[model samples]
Target chain A: MKAKPKQSRYLTLVLILGLIAACTPPAEKTAEPTSIVEADPLPSWNDGPRKEAIISFVEDVTDSASPNFIPVADRIATFDNDGTLWSEQPIYFQFFFALDRVKALAAEHPEWKNKQPYKAVLENDMPTLMQQGEHGLLEIVMSTHAGNTTDEFDSLVRSWIDTAQHPVKKRRYTELVFQPMLELLDFLRANDFKTFIVSGGGIEFMRPWVEGVYGIPKDQVVGSSIQTEYDYNNGKPIIKRLAKIDLIDDKEGKPIGINRYIGRKPVFAAGNSDGDLQMLRWTDANPLMSFQLYIHHTDSLREWAYDRDSHIGKFDIGLDEAIEKGWTVIDMQTDWKIIYPFEKNQ
Target chain B: MKAKPKQSRYLTLVLILGLIAACTPPAEKTAEPTSIVEADPLPSWNDGPRKEAIISFVEDVTDSASPNFIPVADRIATFDNDGTLWSEQPIYFQFFFALDRVKALAAEHPEWKNKQPYKAVLENDMPTLMQQGEHGLLEIVMSTHAGNTTDEFDSLVRSWIDTAQHPVKKRRYTELVFQPMLELLDFLRANDFKTFIVSGGGIEFMRPWVEGVYGIPKDQVVGSSIQTEYDYNNGKPIIKRLAKIDLIDDKEGKPIGINRYIGRKPVFAAGNSDGDLQMLRWTDANPLMSFQLYIHHTDSLREWAYDRDSHIGKFDIGLDEAIEKGWTVIDMQTDWKIIYPFEKNQ
Candidate 1:
């Protein structure tokens, strides 16, 4: 049948529209998608004031027209490693590494069987170790952590992490990372923030596995370090770890470490203990729109809950400051849908 | 006035070819372009073996099908800043900063009028300052460099650099940067290499201006630093720079600094003095295909030419090693057509 000129023109218009639609991405078709299919950058974070605050802050800072908008280069976020990003309940995970290292090296150092801290570590005498305090910890750390090239130390750490399991959880140490924190990291990175791990743990120990575990590169992880010397053995340059401490990145040292390593004030800082108080305060002091978050350990069922009186990761000063300063205090017990990644299947 | 079916089909083929050609970028049209419009990534470099070697190495490493192909994450390049990147004549540029700072602060201390190093700096007596040696240098450095908060120090440095001029050439210190080296940095970055400045100068002193001058961000600069303490002065967190040295970042300290800061050995390294020998050797020791380059000061007319005899940036050990190890030695007189970027217009 012959078609009229108006009908033919209408048919051409429909064909052109179809072609244009075909070239466009499927996700661009709708202005908004239903909640079920919508992208959740922070999927593990439940709907709460804390989560909303974070979202709103990120959106405001990244919006070009917003007064709070910060350039992408200035979007620095720092995370405290121990209790903030992972479990540090019974003790710091690094202490376990030190203890295990003492046991592993005790065979070669027969005198360690008679030494105070080494003997205590070998016999699992926590009381004696505690009595010795910082001195005892230093002895154990110096013995196990030094006197090897960086490459040798890195290999040792890599192997130890591969086999080490948490005593209570019976899971690989790397698997204990907080799932919600991981989501937060991704969300911040997606919004053009450069995330760094500012930790009190050994820098070398964390550098070996940080990229694999947290997706933070080795250079981006700043932490405590022992003195090292550059030497040539067999005509090849090597950096030998010395027993003396270079920088203790704990307590007040956190802010110093961030300034030394990053050379810029972070806009966002998250921490869990008093060790991170100075870091939080530093970030809060920024004139720009800043976010200071503290992960409060209130989940006794899902995770160990302790603060103020805890031997490890004591959270007294920082908790008081967060409350007084109106910083976001994440009630882990209520806010998190899942604690560790392994909890997803269960 | 009628076309044959075969002729009509040929016309349709030509139209299809034209549409495909229109969609492709202009650069893709030709496999290569001759000198006039060719992409010379290192335009400051003259046509010679040194330039060819660099281009060939970059091409080999970036080619996915080649055995020498390096992943972007593994493509690390470290450059020594003082003599290699910029002029170190009339003493290292940082010493001038220290001297100026001493004069600026001299009025505060009446005792400084008699103090050996401070007195020499105030009098502009170079001979006495040299006589004081390392001990005298440390005294001058500590008096001028420490005791201020990191932010305060940054502002002071920024202000000083904005107004300071070279003692001899009278150019801004930043303007003395080598043009060829700047081009090399861009070339390396274009090939996906993460470039870092590993200097023996003060980290804080360099951080304020490096981003603007070198295109290398503050976080990527590794250098000597004094100890810093995090303290609260009236409820505000501040990092106070202390008098004591934390790291030297010279000679054997270069490798130690690299290990502590970068945590990964660079696949490429460039330097111009004995201080950088260990760094280059450490880079060469990497298991990957690597490149080591040294810039030899051979241009006396355009720039000050001093090497082994010069107290500043002495190149004795490194010059010998470069020849013996078959590393690229860039003869500044012959290899460079222009020295500094400011010379381009002239």
Candidate 2:
């Protein structure tokens, strides 16, 4: 009796309700927005060395008469895309998305079960999964990312980001971006600074969402990328994506990429792990007045902390060196007022 | 008798009086006004086909709704330093500057006669000069450029440019710049384009006067350069120049330099020789709307007119190809209202 037309009608109603909710405006007001009234992400950042350092640097450098003053034209700032600007817990947000894509498309492609990386991803075996490391990750990306042009892949990523949720948090990864850092980016840009993202992530992967997430436009985002060839396919000129890595925009490669793309050394730099140490050092070595800040993940309950020896985002020697050089070190546990956006419920 | 100081002084005064009377403002405005009317350089350039083409392309790309519309942030335009925007005749301005430097400092450096390229330049021997070609040019640049830190070398170039005059035209090299191209540069920049000078000239030599001459700030000048090392000299860290050529920014090197430095294809390319051919081709290959224009030196009266076989600033194959491709070929004789600033004869 329940499996007849009544169930079909109920399904239709649910679909219409979901579409209506999607179209509805967010509850937050535009002028006096409720979102703006939320907890400050870095409330514990006292008006001491941490806060004063940034203000003094900005004021001094922006003052033309000051010996350390850098012209507004030369004020370039670079930020790491991963943990520095957004959350990278459990696994990097991209990895989680790739895993989900493999599962969702598995029914369409029955042979995925026999495939190596997709099979490993589908089974949800934790220890066995990561054993593939970068090689395994590259395989998953190539299998899913290829077979189409760059524009087609960008659409796929956009669709995934619109609906997919983080495994542990059950919230969109876009919501996991650090609100404090977003504010900082806006503040820097407001003061006539050109902010750029220099990341180890795939260039094509991050380019689609970077503008929306960080307010940094696509051209300003430099990252790892596979070699792409521009070709005419069926009278349409398309940039075809390849499976092999063309360049890795990480570590020493960071400085190379910065000099290659930016044509100027950044006066301000921020990062979260060892991968960013070279970029910080490069920024510090510039002739202009410079600032380098490293984010130290030290909170567990609030947002899960694992630094030092973490395989995914190691921050050991870099942390020690930052302290030695008197660089700004952001202690996540004590400095941040809030962690994830959902943590406000606590 | 003329060797006496008083006679030379009297002769100089007489010459000054004669020139002032001939070239100075009218009697009523001689001391009354004498205002330096900072000229627009190319005010008479009616919005013609070339101007319309450029404006339409930029407008379409910068407007978000248009299919070709790229963001203003992604609007990048690269211009060839010589011939495209300025005169490169009698000799490339940089080469002439190098020769003048060798001559002016010859009194102190008698040992230069014993050197290879210096000896070749001192004798004013054209055949031997052409024989050395690029290799000799590098030698001349290194001798004049190295042995000082970047700051000191920049000052040296600045001083030479400030006092020096072109041997043939008898005007300052900066005054020999094309008025029409200057307008084009400012026009592109006004529309939020990032314009760069991609040249074969020594980077250090171009940086000092480029800001004042072209209004292109130092950071935007990409050129051939010697290797530099960061060193602690006299308790201050500085980039010290060396004699070794790290990169040559010319011909095929031009495209490589653009790729290595800017990381994006130009939306608009303007050049004047075969050296710039590859750069224009590269820019023309952009999937987005693009424009390429070449300056053909066809006016013998207004400016030196020789192409196909001219030794300096040659325009053989590039001119033929530009005509074949139906690219806008700027006829300097007919298209321009003025050539060099001094060519006005005021």
Candidate 3:
């Protein structure tokens, strides 16, 4: 019964209203954001401020019409392996591997039974080993990590990762990976972000299992590395792992490692320690809409929750900075629905 | 009139013959290969043994039924950037960049006018610079390349590449990229191979424009790099390039660099000099079907031609090895339809 002109004008008004609603800020809208239309990409992340911030930021950067839109090629994300992605409670996983290696090789080197750090490692004397400090740790690392071809070292690392269990958790080290972080990685990758593992752990040690556990390929991993020399062994090319230190992907080294390996500023960076402060600072200071996420270990019952004063992953400085900068601070206990992937089944 | 059973049997026989024909090898077949269905991927590559071998190898490795089939993730192809992807005549493009930098900075440092390599560069005396050798070259490189933030260096390189002209050709340095090689890169990428530039040039220098010139991303470029330090300058994060030699991606260093950067052996490797011998050897020795291609600079009319005795990109050992191993030797004069992409419009 409506006139043709009246109907046309009504239709135009509806269309204009829809366009305005689409362009409205997410905070002003009642409807779910477009990013939330797909099945929850971060199912493990509980519906919280952290999750919402992450999703909104991703949507803003990926949406072409948005002023904050970042090109897919420039969507680089760097992640910290220990503490951030997985548990680093009893000590770094690589340190445990090195300690185990020292014990395994003790029979061959009878002299190690008498040496200071080696003897401490052989006897499982944590106090004595800790007393030796960085010097002792380096000694232990060099002795067990060097004198082998890269292939041999890789094989060794692979075998150890396959079998080694975390001391207190009694779980395979890879099993301790944070499910929420894993979901976060997948979410970022689905949005055309290239994810990299920027770790302080030995690069070779992580390369063997990172692809299998984290979906990050070997080349995408930037970590502390020992010097390797190319030599012909029995007329076959071999890269011998040397005792010398190359680059350490920690503290200020994180930015340097990102520059050296990725050759691009990361749009997103996640870490859980003071060592990650510079990396967070770098990522936050990116000349774009960058996201700096820090995972705070607040889940004491679900996972070991030591920070600020923890020896392994000290978080005091970074935590303060995160608050000051308004970066996403993931309170693990409240933010994550599940801690480890295994917890979902339980 | 034929009986019904006889007619059915005749139809089955025809279908069997068609299937057999489809499965026949290219050499034995009358029809075009499936890969050729889409357009000539390498139009600049003149139809020859070299081009045929490359196509055949790529098909074999990518074929699912073939025993030598490599999964897409493992299908890495590394190309030397300087002489393999681009022309390196008279001297390396990088050496030219370094010399120009020296001359530009000579005004600020009057002392450089008296220095060995700097003085040679200032005076444009190639003989004197050559006599000073690698030591003098390093001195010049360190003086000009270091002391700047990576961003500043990148900007400088970007500006220079955009404006600087090739001495003899008077073309932009990027215009000197080999057309055939560019086509080859695209062809390999289309066939699911991840292409990387494993060059001996400074990584920082090449990172600025390689993506635009060669379509190879910065992270995929493995090259010589200087040490860089992360520092807080004026309350901002900055990575300062240092004068120290980090990794030299040449000769034996090529294989080491590939392993360090790509973290996997390349299935296909291409180069034009002895410096790439180790890289080719590494690729050829992969535990899968591999292709080693050496570009022989036999084209004097279209591009400068030099081989065994040339100081820059010397092709002595690699050329001999290519012959011994039955590797694909690209006789640039005969095999390439065009030398540079710019020549196509002409």
Candidate 4:
């Protein structure tokens, strides 16, 4: 087999190529309905009062004959993006994007080398960045996100998402999304529910990848964003981005955002943190077959679990409220069949 | 013929009952789809670049096999709640709710009897109320919206919507929603598109009835809101509303609100007036299949037709930009199969 050095090297290359080709996932197939009733992802969910309550609500409301049957135009459901539909462990996904943006845009703005958050970001100094806190995060986001028009900003976001990878997980940021939650989104949409991602992240940050990752179109995603200014330059008009925080979209802001943006009260609401408490409360208060669910991160093996004290994606107050209010608290370790699509038990 | 008096009275009673029964819709069929479909609601739409573009985009994005195939989770589609989804011809729906709220709450707070906007609202003096401008509207909203938790405020709104009637339309505000737009929302949801209502209306004012009107749930609604305080009163913590304008969900505010609330850019957006232009602009900036539709009120018979100068839902700058930008401009009169779902149309 080792006839010559050159011959052996060529043989090794061929074998490596063959293995790589075999390991690659087959081209994605056309998703088709295999059966009308195939499988239930959350089979452990008991057919008790809570579960039946949802089913009966949907049935009675969706039924045209029932006085309670709501029109199809009104079957809206809203879910918080971070922690609710996707995992927000260690840090938020958007913050990672911000850090990457800071690094990418740093070379152009060498002044950022001395800046607080950017300096911290470029040096991979998490502790320093944390010290800078929300104001620092805002500065970093504004510096990296501003100066460009909305169009240019969107491109930057899209490019970064396409190339960025989570440092710890060594996976694309999109791959970090929870699989069971993804299935839940699909299930809701399949049942005529209009699902929305109401998050406190930058609006433009999620718009680029949400369609590809969450199946939610850009318009359906509501998030926090910076202020913008429209002006004329060289006889041409253009909109320029400004670093100022236009609105803060968290906590009580959720209900306000929902009211202004969606102009409706959701029949169903889901979140993983206290930031979404008001949204859940507002939804539950409605005189409809409404439901609210909270995601509890309790598993450390599959993912980090630090609920009582976490700088980002805190879940302490909301978790207690969920329990006290008899809300459906999804036990990440016990309930979820799979946490993420990319990971398999080692 | 001599027995005509008794016979006439009996016959009149039967006729009156028949008319009343006719006014009400046939008991909605329990098994029927929640809203109308297959009506080809927008028949005047040419099978040209504009119409086909949207249809093809939706079809391709929903195919699952296509490269543009969006996941069900990311199928969020945002809409402008005013003219785009319903009639904002002579007045905004919130204005109507405000007027009624002012009158209902007037006798209790007689000081409003001498107030500017409140007095105007109480006396049905819309002209004076309009003059109070956005400031007046905010005042009215705050006065009616304050002194209660979000839950209590929502109940008040619900009760008002359930009973209030539009002066000219003489129908519940819920019935004022455009039939075609309602179908569009349903169609999108059926195809896994999550629909939302983004508006300049007060958040608390709209959430109570939006689900009933637009099929958009409370949490899916985003709108302008005031600052609130959550406190424990009488051993029960309650979220009290305030008069301070925390945020305005219109124009530039739209994009920021979109960011803060939905966390993703919408693939599709439909709006009328300059308030929605930035939202449309933001949505169009997405890399994937995207669309921005403008509702041009061109039908005076079924609905009012005035662009560029209408005070209520003005469409001057937006109309020009839409045409130049190649956005879908729906000529409401010509394109619609029916303006509203009423006895005559149905």
Candidate 5:
């Protein structure tokens, strides 16, 4: 009772019923190739220079006869998740998740109502929360994200991802993912590229829903993780997620995370902020023909547009480097036909 | 120039030239799967109860209509490296690597000619080296394994693997990989299982050569690691491998490493020693159907056989658990037709 690939499943059914005529015609039907452009793979992307460059890079690496041909085994493409794949405007989506968690758990830990960061979160005071800064954010993240089995945390994230909506968008956080980026992921996979998410976000938080939303499987994700311990509770084993930080998986940590988890340099890497500069540099450093893409949020009317001046997902040095190096900078305003999938009809 | 999957390359060429005759037959020719066994995928495995069970497990998990059918993404299979996949006799093979490295490095560190561990390593003094114990081993391992950039370390391991031979076997260390295990890996992969090497060996040490020897990719390897630092050496970036221990990847740490790197519990896991107990337990704990395998070194004539009373690759607890749980146990002497690839002809 071996699991069959989709192609083989149909073939098995046809062959069992002695339907050779059924299989032959379908094979010939798919033979029409060069006469047509094989459907616009990146349909969400506008036919701009950035889109052209991205398609060209994929073609260069995949064409076996070309000088830039990369082996399929080495066709690793990494992406920064937050701003690169999904919206990180207002603040990182994970912060909202943490805030919501803090509110949910406030019932159990009533002291949160009086606590500085927790109190600020409860009152929905942004300035106060920002004043509390890194330590406060870590406190909220660790409190809600850890102190449970990985299974329990996965359940928590699944519940939140299923129910919670973006405060501004009035859509699920998963819905905030870029349609262009989703198309890009599909296009890369269609061409035999293994796409991975090397994110600064909590690995567990993304693992539960990434497969559904982005089509990136759990194991393919490389992200910031808390220290975990194997707790063999009388043979009912569980991996305990501790509050201690294990990996940051951002900036310099991105390359290190790639090395640790992937052990191969990505031929293509995409990012949005200065935090992604190191990863872009790392991908560009690959001996193979590599592509570095920077997504510039220039569409204020469609998606929030803030770059260098913004505190969250600040694009300063990486923007300068992308411009200087002539890397593909995705002008979200002009280059994207649509922002989120919800905007497709509009 | 996009990298072409072999299947598509031929199809594209035939369709472009309008050669319909060349393409039609290869499709239906492969349909006769039921009449014959698929080329005896595990050729090196003897036809015994262990082999039967292993094959049955694979068939059970892979059959699409079966209740036990695991989806391709969930079909993760992990193998312990040292004593399980290859031979780890007299001492762990990595120890041999470290000892040889110490001798090669002795001229640079002149004090090492008289040093306790280094002197012992240079003189081939096993009894004295054993006396220095874990602390001494760690010093040798760290000193030899770290301080270089990951690239440099990769080169060193590559060079060593290219030349190093097992003392007892007099064969290249890579050549000593179990023939049956290699076949098992291929069989699993052919069935769409993603195979990974989850070893206690150094991550860098395994990455450079495992792909060449075992057909397992570098990223798929989960192993013990030293802390790596991203050094942007005037824009010529390098990840410096430090002497600090980042992960142990043994015993309880095996499961922890699996969690960190894979982020999912494997449905299939194989091991030979007590150190792999936790990983096996964790895999068995998978909610989906799971298969745990223990490689019992019962072939004293062909390979060194020591299990319950052995110091290296001690198999007491794992053996008892395998027997008690009715899990698959590979008796090397009885179940394997050949030990290593070199022995295939013999």
Candidate 6:
């Protein structure tokens, strides 16, 4: 689907990781459960309104005596996967998966070394790739993401996520997640709030490994998608992925995706960019007492910090709105004692 | 979207009720718990292979020592709506909803009495209404179902469902759901199987009350949809419903819907028509020890029974496939002690 120019490149990014370790998925969803004793739900935080806001909101909503008390089933919390829950510096992670796939399959498609977008990807030229815009990105993504059975694609993501290293940070992409956010996810789940990931990344790409990394399950994660076909090859049944786009799941799409997938309005929402504006606003507009937070990536040393003029995960207009609404804007350098999960070990 | 002519009229129905009360939805989801003790997981099911097959399959898959043992997270079970879980005789309940909405809105649009499809509806003319074909039905459905805020549509359905009576059955549409299936849903939940409704009905239509009616939460429901927009209505954010079609979720679309929403193939699937053949085949195709069932509507005296030639939920090809695959064909009259929950009152 060729989207309107304004709804262009940003629409199709689909990120799908959850909890890192809940349901034993504490790796996020299934691998290693992030260990937390009952004493402190969020230990990584330095302690302030940024941290207190999360605790106070949870306490008020879960407290039956409070006027803000929301029932367990109605207590839905949505978070943007990229930047908000983890890092999306330099560029989005799924884009890396696309570029890596192009390079991996370069040997198969000999002509790709000469092709425009394919050439840009093969040479690891970010500047050239940026010029291709949404069209180029879609071409690269569809070539690698589509054209396989769902099970085959699942294994592809699983293998890649296990060994793939972040280009700049030189850390496993999963380990780059904010420790405070992970604790927040666990804290919310502990309070009977059903947490979900609403992203602009591929739904399939995220489902493969999010559980072990986020404790969020496959079903709880919603993201942008491509069309799929149910194929009956003689006797075997397989879902064949089609290159055609299904949902964009970005900007205004966040709330639309929530309605399609989650149904009820989320009382809690968190995001990091202009892309997340609609979701935060939607949460703020909920009839129930709601909480909205904007994660300000201000820690230039611990994490890449970019806003206003930055291209990837820009946080300009959303930041303005967060401040205007009196929503919590966490200044990362001042608020967090540490950033990544690996920092805790150090 | 003008669908392929073959995929026309049947593409837009969205039935959203589940375990009537599963989360307490045992009403299949919530109003009443149905008062079943742990002793009998399925009291409505008669003592036969149809019943025994369910017990054995569950025991095998849930048993840790059994070769068929599936991990708890992997225990997904999907079901078809309409005839499989509830009654779809005469026509789909959503069609009834469309008709009623048209009638309710008729006082505002006197021009409808003179219009073709709406005139056909106002006159209570089925054959004339059927003659309007898919385009006419879409016109009727879109007129009533679309153009409202999502919250408004939610309230509309809620108000209508509370008071509306089934034209023929005389009972409420929710009351027409199968007693045995409700028991089956509760049974599966007890054993750790995650049950879902994979229907061709409207996603929004089912979300509001399904948790109370089927015990399945709002997020668990997946069905056909139209486009919606996130409008900041003077800062009062609302998801505005659009008449544009989204997903059809029928036939081959069933497996596609399963992939899009649940992101996993079900180990058990049940249905009553050819529309569900792909889902049943998809479940049967699962690499696990899967179970497939076709509810053969065969008891006219107790419940309306029509099979191969029935217009609403024809069960010809699916029934033949079930028998050939050696899968269970639930003989409704013989296999069920009661067809509906109300029968228990008598």
User: Which of candidates 1 and 4 reaches a greater lDDT?
Assistant: 1
Assess the local accuracy of residue A218 in candidate 2 as a C-alpha lDDT between 0 and 100: 68
Tens-place lDDT per residue, model 1, B1-346, is 0112221111122122112222212111111122222688877677899989999999999999999998887788999888889987656777778878888888898899998868877887655665775567667778889999899999989998898997557778898899889989988998899899998888999999998888897888998888787778888778888887777777776787788788999989999988899899999999889999999998777775667845443578899999899999999888877788876665
Misplaced by over 4 Å in model 6 are A5-38, B1-5, B8-38
The root-mean-square deviation over C-alpha atoms between each candidate and the true structure, in angstroms, is 20.5, 14.0, 18.3, 15.4, 15.5, 6.8
Overall local distance difference test of candidate 1: 0.79
lDDT of 6 by residue, A183-208 (tens): 88999999998889999888899999
Worst 10 residues of 2 chain B by lDDT: B1-10
TM-scores of all candidate predictions against the true structure: 0.87, 0.69, 0.88, 0.66, 0.88, 0.91
Per-residue accuracy of model 5 over A203-295 as CA lDDT, tens digit each: 888899999999998889998888887789998999898877777777778888999999988999999988788889988888889999999
Best by TM-score: 6
Model 2 chain A poorest 10 in a row by lDDT: A1-10
Top candidate, metric lDDT: 6
Model 2 DockQ, alpha carbons vs. true complex: 0.07
Q: What is the lDDT of residue B56 in candidate 1?
A: 92
**Cα misplacement distance, residue A286 of candidate 6 (Å):** 1.0
Question: Which consecutive 10 residues in model 1 chain A have the weakest lDDT in total?
Answer: A1-10
The CA lDDT at B175 in model 3 is: 90
Q: Residues A1-346, candidate 2: write the lDDT tens digits.
A: 0012221111122122112222322212111112433443333343357666776787789888999999876798999877888876665677666667778789988997877656766776554554654556556766776666767778888888888886556678888887667777877887788898988776667877887778886667777666455453443445566665544666655765565456467899999878788788878878898999899877665565767866464578789879998899987766665655444443
Ranking by DockQ: 6, 5, 1, 3, 4, 2
Model 4 agreement with the true structure over A1-346: per-residue lDDT tens digits: 0012221111122122112222323213222222223566333333355445455666677778988866666677888887777766445667666667777787799988898867877887655655774456557666777878766787888888888876556677787787767776786787788888888776777887888798876667777656666443443434567866554557766775565466556888988887788788878766666778888877666665657545453468888988998888877766654567654332
The DockQ of each candidate is 0.30, 0.07, 0.25, 0.12, 0.31, 0.55
lDDT of 1 by residue, A1-346 (tens): 0112221111122122112222212111111122322677777788899999999999999999999999887899999998889987456777678889999998999998898878877887665666665556667777889999899999999999999987766788898899889989989999999999998888999999988888887888899888777778878878888887666676677788888888999999999988788889899888889999999998776777778845453578889989999999999888887788877665
Ranking by TM-score: 6, 5, 3, 1, 2, 4
How big is the positional error of residue B261 in model 1, measured in Å on the Cα after superposition?
0.8
Evaluate fnat for each of the predicted models and list the values in order. 0.75, 0.06, 0.58, 0.21, 0.72, 0.81
The alpha-carbon deviation from the true structure for residue B123 of candidate 3, after best TM-score superposition, in angstroms, is: 2.8
When 2 and 3 are scored with DockQ, the better candidate is 3
**Which regions of candidate 1 fall more than 4 Å away from where they truly are?**
A1-37, A127-132, B1-38
